[model samples]
Target chain A: MKKVSIKDVAKEAGVSLTTVSQVLNDKRDRFTTDTIEKVLAAKQKLGYLPNKNAQQLRGSKTKLIGVLLPNLANPFFSTMMQSMDANKESDVDLFFLTAPEEDIEAGIMHLVERGMDGLIIAQMIKNPERLNNYLTTHRIPYVVLDQSDDHGFTDIVRTHETGGGELAARHLIELGHKQLTIVQPAHLTSNMNLRMEGFKHYCQSHNVATPKVIESTLSKAGGYAAVDDIIASHSTAVFATNDEMAIGIIRGLADKGWQVPQDVSIVGFDDIDIAQYMTPALTTVAQPIETIGEVALQLIMDKLDSTLTHRDQQSIVLPSELIVRATTARANLDNS
Target chain B: MKKVSIKDVAKEAGVSLTTVSQVLNDKRDRFTTDTIEKVLAAKQKLGYLPNKNAQQLRGSKTKLIGVLLPNLANPFFSTMMQSMDANKESDVDLFFLTAPEEDIEAGIMHLVERGMDGLIIAQMIKNPERLNNYLTTHRIPYVVLDQSDDHGFTDIVRTHETGGGELAARHLIELGHKQLTIVQPAHLTSNMNLRMEGFKHYCQSHNVATPKVIESTLSKAGGYAAVDDIIASHSTAVFATNDEMAIGIIRGLADKGWQVPQDVSIVGFDDIDIAQYMTPALTTVAQPIETIGEVALQLIMDKLDSTLTHRDQQSIVLPSELIVRATTARANLDNS
Candidate 1:
């Protein structure tokens, strides 16, 4: 079997090789309809397989993008991917990179080796400066999908993580809650740390005691394991960073003969779809996932189109809001 | 910058091109350690980017596999992916292929075009013959991950979806539930249909009134929307195919002034990570996702290693069990 080249298609269609290449590559506006049809028919008949590597070497785009995610199992990331998938304009393929690595430098190198045109980095943990410098040196087009505006110098599509933290605290404090606790999964993330800072600062300024923070896994098991310690503190209110942990806290409290809101109020972050359907309907902070997805896609597309240059840096921040529901209420005066 | 060929590395290292190629690949045992180091050093110093297209044409494995899933946002799929990641050998990269299409023909084509070594199709729909024929024609090694063994002829790794469905029905019937309902997501998946078939068959044999079936999206919103219709039907027990719907049922029922296990006993399928964390601590059927992942990996690995042939078709069926928790209880005689 021989590889079908543009010359073969041109000879088969009785047209120039340039015409065949242009027609196959969406540059058919200059050609007549009959000529375009002839080129396409000949190419199809000859069983032409496009040499993507050769095309990239010839200044033709690969139409391939890399998506780096910390955890694919996390629904938040999936939502972002789905949003991008919906906004796709062509046959662009998205390669997901999740290798359980602490950082994505090696992953980025692999993507570059594979000839990716751009990348989207979500839920990052590495320093912004280091990554920005590396991407800049490599001439890779990328946007950081984060939940906070802590990225000092880089292209970032983020939600107001600090405002979200302050909103949760403000809502609880206004409910007359004196004893409060913050439950976060794993260590404090870049956004989680900012949230913690904002939460503490607001409490201190208002003359309220700062809430004790607990670090655990982002899963329900982690939240379940910390139930005893949380109960021992006798906090009237709890703010879990993500919805998964907050749901676990509710069950653990239930097992210990405690009722939510009536005994202990609970608030969660990332108002995922399931949050609204939980028993008592969790009160949470909503991250604009769809907006982040759309903005991230647009930024990467602009870079790919050469409209956004390397020197052009952007750090667009979206708003994160608190959604009050059945889980939170005025702290029982006696419990406080 | 010029392309560095294997010959260049050989010339620099003062070794044969064949020796350099062999050392760069798996056949390194025959070469001396000194020679191998020299070849590697020369290859690195020249900044050689190995032409993967040429390597693939020469029968070198891509070390890339595609995992085709119906929904990546569903944590069940993520759990399977994580399990596969844990069982990963060497540096094989897993690319997630998810399109909004119901059939995976287009997705399969895209993966093949991108040069995937193999594929693992999880939560598959009906009709194995079409996919089996296509895969066989293309010589692409693949295994269908059905939750039920209703496939006509193909390689499949599945759980006892029939037994799972029957187990839920048996538990509800034993609890004195007469008017029951099976709430499944969508129009009965290949696995869900079998579960429904088994559940209905057992009830028919026992002279018990067969439960009614409802089709909707596999989300909380779907379960919430169907609450009124289910209550109007006077269903004392409800069996949701997944935990998402079951959780929604509990919340929807509470909104309608009914309590789980008191007015209605609800059982869910796929005891996901958040199941135990639900306020009522959901009782559900657990799919052996880890076992499925391991088995699926083994099947694909066997194919890649040439130990498993296309003629060697296997249909492995694993058992599933019911986990009774706080969500299910003895039916109230008054309600019946």
Candidate 2:
């Protein structure tokens, strides 16, 4: 099959190159309505595919948005990406960049070099100085989602992470679990720190003793390690910052023949898809993942349209609810 | 914050517009190597960004490969995408398209419209006629992975799916299980069909009775639903086509007070990351996910280089290994 070109499209439409170019780029002000209609008819007749790359180079919006996610395998971020991909069909297409925390710079540069019009970045790097420099220097339109803090740029979307922490603590306290421990990732961030702070504050306000806070990896192995720490401390309840770690704690406990909610109540954050379906139907805080994606995309669109800017920095804190599943219950007197 | 153009780059490089264009498009064969170097140096010095879209229009290659995966949240596929992204770093970048079986055409057209130079598709669709049509019509360079039956389109990379199925069945049979069941997705594809065939074939050859087979979704919910069917049939052993579904099945069985291996043995495929961390450390067949990703990307590279064509329909099936974990055990005659 012969490849169709701008000349073929113009010839079929009975229009000049400039007129067809204007119509293809939607520069309708430069072309008459009749010319636009003729070009459309010819485009359909010849099945002419417009050169998208050329149009993008000419400063025509590609309607393609790039999202740089941390890990697509992680259900939390993957679910968010899925929602954005499904919901942003009317005006924009989405491309994704997946980077581990260690490869943040490479991921950022990948999208930047691709000539993406807008970006939605959800990564937690140890330092945002490079990212900040890049964002500030380029002034590319962007929205940051679920980051620990502002890198002094763009609109931000966040959950009420601290609220979720408080709810987890309060739930354990209400269940008559006094001795508590917070299991967290080894590398602390403002995000994890805030949750820990909220949990501590809740316990203090309720006249309960400050719970022991143990730092571990946010992975299953980390949860397994937390088990030994819990056993050593003889804590009645363990609060994991994320559902993965929380479930890991459950698995670790089961391996040790320590029953969940009976010997030790476990609470986790980020009610991922598998949380509810876990054997104990994990007791955790549900983050509004889909809503977060929708809101973040909207914020990016607004920024691209010049409706929002860095000054706006719209930090949205969606409510987090504690869902009591089989993981948490009244403290067992046997262990106490 | 004005946008920079090729003319600006040429002026900075002290070269003619045509020379700059040639250098930018890597048409350096027409010019002296020294002249090409000078233009490139000037481009970097001036931070001159090439208009990728415009260059893509004039060039035969987009330097963009599209990867159409089934689900981003599935660890198996997500990890594959991650590794592919890592390996495809020398000038070729990736665009991602994800669609369900029903949305295959939309996905194909989406990638086509974006001018993808080639594609690496993991089409888990039941009926691939639409998928076959789009790839054929466009003569799109492609490499299909994980799906069964090469649609006679070359550049295919598949794991030993049937062999994996056979291994799962033999594993159960060796454990003295006579009655078994296999749970697969509701929408059956060649992938599932082949797996079922492998299982049935092994059962027949070994004089083991063919067990019950239930079709369910590839999700945790589907696994949950298939449990009642397994329970009703009183199968001593079950095989889940994928690890996620198997995890779901285990969860469902535990919910029904059925102890794994003691009363029934469960096995799953696609030893995903979470497989080792499952409560019973899922006994399953492990596909070489990283190798599949690398091979698929290499195949796409082959297609882009015109070293392979659709008529070749070369299929590469990597072997799978059975990893025995805590999930499967010798059938307990005491239950009988």
Candidate 3:
């Protein structure tokens, strides 16, 4: 029941204690491949885990990064988390925390208290200035992702929200649909608001009547509950802010005896995994989720390694593409 | 920039340091409600966060729990995590780690090394015996959730896998579907194998021909890829082990010019949030994810509090139910 120590690994590998420590701490560049392999094998054989706290006390890197996300039940966020987890370096460990709006501050504090070398914040922060100040004061390297507002003091990675919205609107408008409706959550984040703005801008510029807007929660249930309103609006085409809502709307339409792309066409945002698997493969604005994850992680790592300084404040805006699928079609102008 | 200390809170609240410590550590039963409120308000005003490591050094609870899930992309697991996170006590913080099959051991070590008071593991552990020994030796309280195999030494909470499979089989049989198929992953876990066994058992008992089995990865893409094989099997009814695959199967069938419930009836397991939102409102076996998460957290808390000893080894199995939705219907024997 005795705890295995670096000494045991050193003895087992017939190496010095310094060699064992160096290998375990990821300072193996100076060591030959055979020696490094031997140390790792010895450590594995002895089942030795370098305690993060102990390592911190010894002034070595914990090699741990913390990520704060809005929701995991939503496939978009979960898939992003999965991609980051998959792409992170093997020696670096990630701790994930899901924080609804009210919990963002507390969640950030929890990760900070854990002494993470860096952080990735994907949720909306109520006070970006205050958060930047806090993180800077604590000397913690961090990056912001998916938040539409300029973080002012941190590197930001996000998709072109406005372009995404315009793409959805243009597709539906091009289908000869004069009556259009957009579904979104009652409480709008900056990113969601930008999408709405872009949609409105596109419609106004095209000299088409402004689309009717329906407010609902940002979830499947929200879209389901908005079905009655959608029907009453008499819109021939609908643009849902996210694929989850679109899926719910599609089901709701079917339940009410309305057919997709025949009675109504639906365009959704965020081409999450299940979007394509829906009955009439949803036409959506495809955000490069995998690329975003990679960029965000790399940004954080650069900061952690002192390659990207705090003042750099890099902003990378990735493009969103419109994916044409079965759900969208020519409007039934004869019925109109 | 000075760190907030207990003394600062004590001065702000006009209470002694001992009172502040006791209140913050959940030992406030002896204090009046007024005193507890004042201490909490003072702590909030000063933004004082107790250093967990410092408290641990003083022999106080760290109030941290670690959860290991197989995959966050799976709605079933993600929803369970969300439930547990929502239901945990305010003072308790949960750290989440997603570990695929190969990373389970390393994930456990990482959490344990961080000195978490308790652990909830929802993923499959290859060497439960070794894990049990290691945890016991370290005096860490832990519980296994959703793992089908019995651990000789830890508490377990899981759904009735066999009963779930039986429910699926019974529904299809009652619908008069003679050609049945059960789609599962290529590599079966003990729990998945149990589901298949119960499905076959029900078919045998009913004197129906042995149902055909199709192997695919446990994902939407996997199900979509297996569509040709499923069609070749000529199954009048299909039972997918999870909702993700069932969704893909439905989409694939649509692509192949087949109609659900008219040409084939499909039932899925783990009625995830999107199940009811599917075009046909997928008929699925529902696992009470919220209940399971609650029970699992409660068990881990009980152990941490010393109310449930390691020797107790409680095995709580919850039931699964079949929800009949639009995707299932009576077989059209004439088409055959």
What is each candidate's DockQ, to 2 decimals? 0.24, 0.29, 0.27
Give the DockQ-based CAPRI class for model 1: acceptable
Q: Which TM-score does chain B of candidate 2 obtain?
A: 0.82
Candidate 1 or 2, higher DockQ?
Answer: 2
Candidate 2 CAPRI-style tier: acceptable
Please write out the lDDT profile of model 1 over residues B1-336, one tens digit for every residue.
123566778899999979988888869999889998999899777645565654654555556678887766666777787788668775566777765556467777677656666788774545567766656545567777854234555568888988998898899889888888888866666787887887888788778898888776787777877798788878889988788888878898999999988999999988877777777888998888888888988877777776443446677888898998889998886776
Q: Give the CAPRI rating of model 3.
A: acceptable
Q: Residues A1-336, candidate 2: write the lDDT tens digits.
A: 224677888998898988888788778987778888999988877667765666566565656678887666667877888788777854577878777777777767667666666788887755677676665555466777775366666678888878888998899999998889888877766677778888999999999899987888877678887888887778889999888898788888888899888899999888888787677778998899999999998877777774333444677778889899998989875675
Model 2, which residues run further than 4 Å from truth?
A: A1-48, A58-61, A100-106, A125-139, A306-313, A332-336, B1-49, B56-62, B124-139, B306-314, B332-336
Model 3 spans > 4 angstroms off: A1-50, A307-311, B1-51, B307-311
Candidate 1 to truth, TM: 0.83
Which scores higher on TM-score, 2 or 3? 3
Q: On a 0 to 100 scale, what is the lDDT of residue A302 in model 1?
A: 74
How far residue A61's Cα lies from its native spot in candidate 3, in Å, is 1.6
lDDT of 3 by residue, A95-203 (tens): 7777778878888887877656688988888988888877775667788888535756878898999999999889888889888899998878888888888988899
- Select the stronger candidate by lDDT from 1 and 3: 3
